[model samples]
Target: MATEGIEAVFLTTHNWGKAAKFFQALGYELDFETDHNSGQLRNGDGPYVFISEIPEDQETQTQIVLKVPDADAFRADSPVEVVTPFEDTHYGTKEMTVRDPDGRLWNLQAPGKN
Candidate 1:
């Protein structure tokens, strides 16, 4: 149930191209890109940066994605308040969200098989 460390930073932006360019200027290499203007970038061995186009109705926000050893076990043993139950993601990761005391949302993720 231990966390390895911060996995990625998820950013919702109105202009994905601009956001991606900004990160690229900062030396982030594009790892993957999708047709919807969503992609992942990496800088050397550091944590990844995931960028996605924000929906019209949603506000732009930044979310930190943490990598846990076992998301399922972490959720079951976590003392923090769960904001979302653990669920498998389309990217082949099991993820869940928990709210901090200050009401900040933290997303936890662990690698999973398809």
Candidate 2:
């Protein structure tokens, strides 16, 4: 069988590790871990929570990752100007990032791309 898509829901927090711990306490299993200042936990029914650490001086963050069928074309088709092109993630995904007018970040990912 072919691999299915994956979603990385960006959950903002002062401390991503702590945020992950909180969710883990609630039964979310650690689907993957990373040292790229981000990590993921899975509730098993929906997208995995991807916690990204933010700067102390920066405002809070709100973001989510959509598993696109074709990240490359999506980058080309998105109405919003593509801010970041497809890049390999440390945890394991090829992704592109886009920011809305409100500064909401969206990650378009093609998992297991390596």
Top candidate when judged by lDDT against the true structure? 1
RMSD after Cα superposition, model 2: 4.6
- The TM-score values for the models, in the order shown, are 0.90, 0.63
lDDT of 2 by residue, 1-114 (tens): 111455666766777778888899999998777776667788878877878788778787766677866544553454675678888876577877777788777677875555
Best by TM-score: 1
lDDT of each residue in 1-114, candidate 1, tens digit only:
677889999999998999999999999999999999899999999899999997779999999988887755764555889888889998799998889899899999987854
Model 1: colliding residue pairs: none
**Count of backbone clashes for each model?**
0, 0
lDDT of each: 0.88, 0.71
Error of 1 at 98 (Å): 0.5
Quote the lDDT for 87 in model 1.
90
Give residue 95's lDDT in candidate 2 (0 to 100).
76
| Predicted candidate 1, C-alpha RMSD | 1.6
